[model samples]
Target: MIVGIDISKKWFDAAWQVDGQGRHQRFEYTDEDIGQLLAQTPEAAHYVMEATGTYHARLALRLHESGRRVSVVNPLVIKRFSQMQLSRVKSDRADAELIRRYGEQQPLSPWAPATDEVLELQQAHGWLNDLIGERTRLLNRREAHAHHAKPNAFVISQMAAQLQQLDGQIKTCERHLEVMVKKSFTELFERLLTIPSIGAKTAIELIIVTDGFRRFEDVKALCAYIGVSPTTFRSGSSVNGKGGIAKLGQGRMRQLLYLCSWTAKTCNPACRALYARLKALGKPPKVINVAIAHKLLRQAFAVATTNAPFSTEYA
Candidate 1:
């Protein structure tokens, strides 16, 4: 039996069907109901669920404990598929049924959770990003206040203290993240870091988001996966504008690359020359930034694929 679980914060809906059977069963969302359903039919082949925030993890854990094969599908992919035939209606029960039928008919890829250590790395990266963003905000506020009127002594002092705390936390997080990356993904880490603008955080992010670079065939595919590939917008007899990136893949990876692009094109001579050439040819600064990010992304992919440090010569 293959079953699809549509999970929510409070409840879960189940759609189940057997391989050679004509009838299918749909169960309304409920807790403790899985145990009963499994008891009635214990020969489960695989149980699939759509990835919803923390909502689906607990149920997945329970199902796994009962020796059921469980997989989570990316919700974005599911949503796209769901819109094809139905194109309009959406409901918990209907979604569950859709997932079940799709699982049976579409030969969709199954989702596997990352290993514990990788999950830890991702969590650490998320925390570090949060701290960095908060610190930036605090610093911006401090700058604006100090430049404005004569700032109140107490308020300025408090802001300074908070900024210092955030700074300390950010450093600590980076240190721990570096240690973890070196410990877990050593050779790949060392090789990739040689590339300009690449760091422990960015490297770890690519690893986690790519699931150790397993999915894509090569570096260029990885570039597309990273979402730096330029997309086109066209009309009847006109190419209107080439806007920002697709923003389709790993968001953290995209954001990290954007930050790297700004520095990479400044500090790395090869990339800086590319930026200057683009600008002199009348390409916008933002366009140059995107192009630089694209190069860095492809270079990172090359480093991973060839097990070599990124080389400027490309020879």
Candidate 2:
């Protein structure tokens, strides 16, 4: 048996295939409703749903705890899958049916929740990201006001106070993150720092994004998830296009890797050699930077997997 669920903030639409017959139902987003649904599902049944942010977390967790197989797919994958259907109709019920069909027809890896420590780190990282974004917005507004012909004194004062408060909050979040990393991911944190150009912030981000490196199967999988993997376009003989990194994965992780690549190219020997060779071949700077970032990620993977610090001579 296979079950598919379409999740929303208030409720979820569920569909299932049983003995070659299809069934559908709607449930409120609550523990009681989830338990009721689970009670009727077969013990060996597989549950599938899209990764709809925090909305899907509770359901997935509950299903997992009940010993049911669950697959939380990416939303992009689901959207593309929907396009394959001939009907153009769109609704929650239709989406649930498609998801159920997707699970029945495709092979998917089972989903696993991260450890409590990693989850905490992820939450802390989210807080830090939000605070940083707020700070950037405030700074941009302050800059715009400063360039005015006659800046308002009151506005400037208000902005200053808000900026100061944000700065303090940001610092506190950073401290909390540091303490969490040290306590929960001490070895990985220290190991990542040993890599050239990787600092505390990058290490924390990597740990959070990779879920302590438990989310991916290997280095290439990690690169693909980070959107640093090169993608090639080819359609028959005439439609061939240039290869470039696919920007379909985590944007923030890619951005951070790109920034780290700038420093890695100069300090990391392997990266430096790769950069020199690419530059000699007249590759564009952006392409070269992405390549460097890819190399750095591979190195991080190697170090993390092997439980060893990065060493240029042995690398």
Per TM-score, the best of the predicted structures is 2
Clash count for each candidate, listed in order shown: 1, 0
**Candidate 2 residue runs with Cα over 4 Å from true position:** 234-242
> lDDT tens string, model 1, 1-315?
667778877677777755665334444345467676576555656777788977887677767777777878888868888877665768877787777776776665555556788779878878887898898898889888888667888989999899889989988988887788788888888887888888777887777677566667877677767788777787777668766677677666888888899889877767888898998999988788888888887777777778877777881
- Model 1 residue runs over 4 Å out of place are 18-37, 40-44, 61-69, 86-90, 136-158, 238-243, 266-281, 312-315
Instruction: Tell me each candidate's TM-score.
Output: 0.78, 0.94
Mark the 10 consecutive residues where model 2 has the least summed lDDT. 80-89
Ten residues in sequence with the least summed lDDT for candidate 1: 22-31
For residues 122-208, write the lDDT of model 2, one tens digit per residue: 888888889999999999999999999999999999999999999999999988988988898899999999999998878878888
Can you list the residue pairs that collide in candidate 2?
A: none
Q: What is the C-alpha RMSD of each candidate to the true structure, in Å?
A: 4.0, 1.7
TM-score of 2: 0.94
